[model samples]
Target chain A: MSLKSNVIGALILAGCASLYGCAGQHSEAALQQAGADFQKVKEDSNVLRIAPKDVIRAGESLARADRLSTYWGSGSDVVHYAYLSQRYSEIAREHTTQALNEERAAKLELERQRLQLALRESKLLSVQQQGKWLEEQIVALATTQTDRGLVMTLGDVLFDTGEAELKNSANRVVLKIVQFLQLNPKRVVRIEGYTDSTGGKQENLKLSRDRAQAVADVLMDLGIEDKRIQVEGYGDEYPVDANASERGRAQNRRVEIVFSDEKGQLGAAR
Target chain B: MAVLALAGCASDPAPNEQFRLTEQALEQAKAVGATADEVPEMKLAEGKFNRAKGNMADQSFKNARMRAEQAELDARLAEAKVLTQKSEEQVNVLNTRIVRLRKQLGDAQ
Candidate 1:
């Protein structure tokens, strides 16, 4: 019975020796691979900076694996420690990458906010410049200052002949006038209309009054107070040119914006 | 006394705390959008966690502890990867907005 037990023990030992022989070779490759992985992560400055504890753990696991590799019939333990070392190295790299990405995102977010603020300031400046340009255009249009006041003419081209409705072609001039009025808030204006001698006196009077009223209505629609405007009609009485020629008659048919003084005192109607 | 010491050395206590910790790590990974379908580390984590649970049931405390520890790290790696990807997307979004703002400022000038 003792001889039989010894034979059985020897057979089991032989089987384990063969199994360990195969496992030893496999674990050697695993250890080398884990060591290479750990070395890569350890050498990376970013990994070391961001995940120092994880790097240390990887080194410890690699050391344990190296110690176990020297033991007989302990191939699985060596492999396990090697795998843990590799995992630690991979995790360290992942943590480093995440930290770096977060840092980049924070910087990008700051840059985005700064650019947005700059764009808003630039847009506001452009609007202010545009307001100044419109003021210049209004001043140029009102260059004609007669005995009546600062007279800005709305020519016949702004409306169809005999039509009181202002045409879309007058939008630019109307917008400029609105802006000018808004800037000079205390100033008032008298809108005077005139017609040529071709029409009957009563009909010409009504048409001229309607045309002047149309301009006042536009000013009010554009947010100018109605109390700041005065409308008048002088039909066929005030002719700037002779009615014998079509060109002179065309010039005679007009609406004029007469600006008040800075103190809101407007000139008396003609 | 000798028999008791021999028995103590022969078997390990149950790794209940390690199991809890590993499960928490897996939950954290999932919360951050890490999925086995996308991240191989998540797959490894889940597989190892399941094997650890089986080892626990079989009273293999040593194997259970080892698997649970590895699984925890795997889950942590997966979570980190997903967070990094999200941060990368945020940086890209910020870059696009900055570019648009720059173009608008240039046009304004």
Candidate 2:
């Protein structure tokens, strides 16, 4: 035999032996190729890329399907390729579905923020008018919060001398309060009436009751449901200040507006 | 000769093609206010799709395969994003028009 033929035969025999001796070595080279290819994939976009792993195992139960699709002899390779292709397609589909869902969630969040901004702007405009009115009527006023709810000071203008009858000038404040209540219907209220110590306890109690009922009645007439109201008359017992002088008496004879506002999901819908 | 021929078949062409397709998908992501960082998630997804495709190609090459099917999932994802962006644009335009018309009507009234 020629030397060239002999060398070729030896090399072929040795190469086959080495290839068999190192059965899993091909996978190391495959991994290297995959890593190099993955680097190229990362440079394609500034976005970080995760190396695609051999996730056929990560896929749900590929063995049975792989066997079923693959047949021996004629068209066996065709069926095998088809089987693997289907698996890769399925995995790709799962990733795509996850991505689409994320996109949808992001869009929904953006829409929510935009709607909230619009709502806030409208509320701001409405409050601008109310703020002007509040500026005029809110002289010497203070605000406080309790377990009961937010309390706003309503001056002594809502009542008459020793009588709970609504004063003529109190109509504006009454109507404004009614409008405010109507705007915020998802709220509860308690009206506490008080009187100066100059009045007897019984008379003060009666005056306080009548005044509270009058305010509650106005609110009811203004379109607030009756169930939302709780009225009480403390009269002279709950005097905010000592009735030693006219100024103290003026302060004592007043109504306290208490609201019990809880954020309830009555009809909040998505 | 066969190895060299196969290597050179679409080496440079493949990178450019992938970049172009990825940019196309990124533009679709952009319309939805995806930050530049978030926008490239599509490319990452496409890279996975590409790897799946490469594995599929390798399998065919080794097994004396008949024909390799190109994975269409990345393309489909890109297309879906494009359609989504278009629909969102349409909705935004409609909302703007509605707001404008309402304002005009209020002024007229």
Candidate 3:
């Protein structure tokens, strides 16, 4: 064959070969895609992993959070986790409770025994999973900007008027917080307690420091790694706004959660 | 009938033979000098999975599962880029490579 003609033919062959290679890639890709789609359907169309136990666990988590909010006289993340974590938590509780009940009753028929075991195992997994989701939310909050820390005001809400020590009702709130800290710990949790500008700097700082310490101590008591928590007294510093009014000061009297600055850590990566 | 088929055959692309100019834009936003946003490719992968799901939602269990799996794959792949990636280079490479491949394919045709 002439050189030019031979080159043209070879190019055609090469083109077809590449196209065929692409076709192969496409084929496998298409199958993988199809399989993934099928899996989604199976997941969505299937029972969707609903468990009575999980629902119960989620309810308990929500109820506990609510009890905490009422006792603290402030915000509760109950509504939030209710929507997000309830399904799994409920499933966890139902299975765990049922398994315990059966064990107590000593009435496990052999046929039902395997199913009970499976439910209990799944319950444990679901609780573990729900805890993971709670961690993710905290991590997301920690990384979010300061104005949006999903933090509760530590002053009026957590303690009685002008009190640095936790209120009787505040104990539940502190315990809930301790649970959160224990489940989702990563870095130093700065409990920078603040107070209204109603007091002098010395008294305010002491109150702030005491309140922060009170909360920190609870977390420590709950077996949180003490080193992971840092307590500070911001003492009306960086007020949310001018302390010209009740609402303004109420907003200011809060404990802050400051994530370790990502700038320094990430910058050090280079 | 044969003549009509011949006329239909004269269409420029044979439809299958002609490929569109496919280009994707990658806006690599850094959180802190990290090229975390392998986001465009991730979106496209997600779209592919979505399309797969749409096309095969009623086909069979295996097919639907596969599509969902691809969605997770794409999601995970995008997430994987968040760590260990330099801010701009990886995205630039992907954007340029896809375009270059398209051009070469056209030239061949």
Candidate 4:
């Protein structure tokens, strides 16, 4: 009976030993993997610089796992510490990547600011050069110096038929006016709109007003002050030519800009 | 040997603080827009934290502590990844602005 008990005890011990062996092999693989991860982060310069604390924690956990692996039945403990070590290493890598991206963003922000300043300076230079050339064009465009101040006409072609929207073809003249106003900050202008005798008087009045306001809007958009512009609509009045022919109608349909003198004293509205 | 193992078990205090820390990490990860459905690390963190809670209830202090420690780091990694993605987007925005500025400068010249 004693010998039978001894045989049974030995069988149980063998089973326990094999079970421990399997756990040990599993934990050994985990420990090796964790060690590899730790090694990679430790050697990385950016990870070391950006995530030193995480790297240290990873090393500590790896050491704990390495120590635990030496114990006979501490397989689970070894694996757990190894897992923690791997996580710390992974966190370190992620932290390093985040820090690097932030660093790149900072540099790019400075570059963007520098580019913005450069663009503004370039625009200023170009505008200064165009100012001299546009001055000559303005003198030529001033068709008459009537009692209504120095009047310059923007033709009907600058707008769509019966529409208030100014076409893109008007950009040059608009820019020239904006530059002229900028050069003479004290001077103001009155924009007067007229249409040919085609639509109803009320419709002509609204369209003419809308067209005049459109030009004022573009001038304001280009940094001119709203107080510097006065807008008016004459409907079918203030015709420069008769409405008997298409060419006469075209001449009659126009928006005229009346600039004040150098003293900013605008003329009385018609 | 069995007595020594019992002594080790007796000496292990409950990982109440570690559990609190793990939960806080998980909350921070979520605050940074790290969702378990999106970030794999967040999924691991949530799963491990849940299992660690179960371990704590079962009075398995050692298992609970180990799992909580891993979960905390996993959540932190998730948060870092989300922050990194945001920073990458910021970089891209700056890149696009820079490209536009370059084009405008080219046109101006």
Candidate 5:
């Protein structure tokens, strides 16, 4: 063979050897990288516990890459297998992250629901306790719990025989009512005044109205809001006792206070 | 010659599909308030997705595929972050409501 032709042949052989060497180095590097990625995924605590299936797949892909690298040298198949192994490891990591996040989210959701239930229970207990307290206060005020809410009666002794001004003895009962109203700002009340059938109809009605207004004025002065009180007079109407006897007439001449329901709704006076 | 042959034969159309999927994922994350609550992760996802597109334009199919995969994962993480933050806000609002209700009960007592 000619010297120049021999030199050309040797150069081609060198180029082929270098190309093969480069391919082998590339495959070896890929395999090493894949092994490192798989080891990283296996070492992660969350991935090990929550992503077992993905970890196993990554392990299997890594094993396949190892076998392919040993059998195929620097072939494209070994590089592809190594790349697949790396992808599998990354997928395992992603799955682990998603699982951990979902677990944390679920825990938070459960905590929120628990807090909601606790708040609801506390609110219910508070309402029940308030209801019991209100009942006791009404009882202390000498009131009756009728369908028309709590009704308390003040006899003629609480006022002068012919005047609308409240007597000194009426202060205690009025104070009690003011305290109850203060305790329940949402509760409204109505003051109803009544009288026996002795005076002229107009004069009796005016006296009754003036007496109801006097009670309401005292309540307003004691810090009760004016909007929470209604005043009315029913002269000799809906009497609780017969007005023929003196005792019955005394009973008829009285003031009645009616408390509203929980919603602050008062019923019609009967 | 072998390098040319390998490039011509092994060029995958899969990177195109992966790029499209990553774009869709980013769009979905943004639609769900990811930009507001998950700004850092959303930005990372967008950056990686844009880089993937640049690689695709440059015909670096392998780099494009890897970047697209990473972008998809980041976008998914952003979506998860947005959901978690929204739930956290709901819990805060519920706590405030409970406090107000308790105050009303105290006032009544």
Candidate 6:
């Protein structure tokens, strides 16, 4: 070829290279958009903290897209890389969301367990307080704890001779016992009445029965349910003292109240 | 003369089947929420699909086939992204429920 033709060919080659450079410049807008998307993802604190690796991958993909668009003018390749960059950013967001949700669930589970434990502890404390209160009330009534149950004895003076009506002075002790029964609704009681040896056996038995029934009536009127009380008249049986002296005979004539077991079942008959 | 005319028709092979397949894939992706969460991938797929249709209109069978194939891949990627996003949302909802239950229990206590 001649020098002129060679020079002309060189000029044509340069012109083609410049035209390719112009085509490369056309991808600038797409590159800018990809860069903006990647920057937005990187700026998200959650993505940065929880999905740093994914964010880095997105940044790398965006850089590759920018390079392909600016240097090679590879339109198809640039678009593919940009799409990949966007997908990576979305993946980073998904991972960050998952991490945050898992953390929250774990915290909630811990809180639930703590609340359950606290509730159980509080219930136990309440039960213990109730038990202590019941014990204090029983002690205040001057009752005796026995194998059968708690027992309180009312002397013969609580009633007029041969009459079943309770005296006014006995009302305070009966009211206290009723209060205790109300507090422990699950407990039942058995009331027993006794008489001295002076009366006929049948009459003594009838009198004892009347007195026991009267005490039960008073308890029922005070709000204790009828089903929770059992009455028995011993009729001079199981006397606590000899009947020879007046004081001993008085001791023999008494009314006794016995509390029941936890299941509300009264113990064996005396 | 008739043979020559037939030959001319054969030279311009239409990419009807490939175009239809790409369109179906795009529709499937959109039905699965690709349009909302996977916007970038869905847009890329749509752009490639439209370009493929343009190539088909110009009777450029080779270019049309290449673009249709790329579009299908992009659509499939978008569908996968939608699936991932749905699972992530479910996890978030479950976490919120657990938190609410815990709060209720605490308040009751």
Runs of candidate 3 with Cα error greater than 4 angstroms are A1-124, A132-152, A185-187, A259-270, B1-109
Residue-wise lDDT of candidate 3 within A199-265, one digit each (tens)?
Answer: 8999998988888888788778778777877788878787876799989988778766554432211
Would you list the C-alpha lDDT of every candidate in the order shown? 0.83, 0.51, 0.47, 0.86, 0.73, 0.74
Ranking by TM-score: 4, 1, 5, 6, 2, 3
Q: Single out the weakest 10-residue window by summed lDDT for candidate 2 chain B.
A: B62-71
Q: Is candidate 1 or candidate 6 better by TM-score?
A: 1
State TM-scores per candidate.
Answer: 0.68, 0.36, 0.34, 0.69, 0.52, 0.43
Task: Give the residue spans of candidate 1 off by over 4 A.
Answer: A1-23, A109-125, A143-152, A160-164, A175-270, B1-10, B97-109
Span of 10 residues, lowest total lDDT, candidate 5 chain B: B1-10
Model 2 stretches astray by more than 4 angstroms: A1-142, A145-148, A262-270, B1-109
Model 1 Cα RMSD, Å?
9.2
lDDT of 5 by residue, A11-125 (tens): 4333543655533656666766777787788788888897787677766765665554443233455566666666667657766666666666666567666666766777778
**Order of candidates by lDDT, top first?**
4, 1, 6, 5, 2, 3
Q: Per-residue error at A126 for model 5, in Å?
A: 4.9
Give DockQ per model, in order: 0.44, 0.03, 0.01, 0.57, 0.17, 0.13
TM-scores, chain B, all models: 0.88, 0.44, 0.35, 0.90, 0.83, 0.77
Residue A165's C-alpha lDDT in candidate 6? Answer: 98
Q: Which one is best on lDDT? A: 4
Ranking by DockQ: 4, 1, 5, 6, 2, 3
Model 3's alpha-carbon lDDT is 0.47
Q: Give every collision pair in model 5.
A: none
Candidate 4 chain B: 10-residue stretch with minimal lDDT: B1-10
lDDT of 2 at B91: 56
Would candidate 5 be rated incorrect, acceptable, medium or high by CAPRI criteria?
A: incorrect
Q: Report residue A180 deviation for candidate 6 (angstroms).
A: 8.7
- Between candidates 1 and 4, name the one with more favorable TM-score: 4
In angstroms, give how far residue B10 of model 1 lies from its true place: 6.4
Task: Return the top candidate by DockQ.
Answer: 4
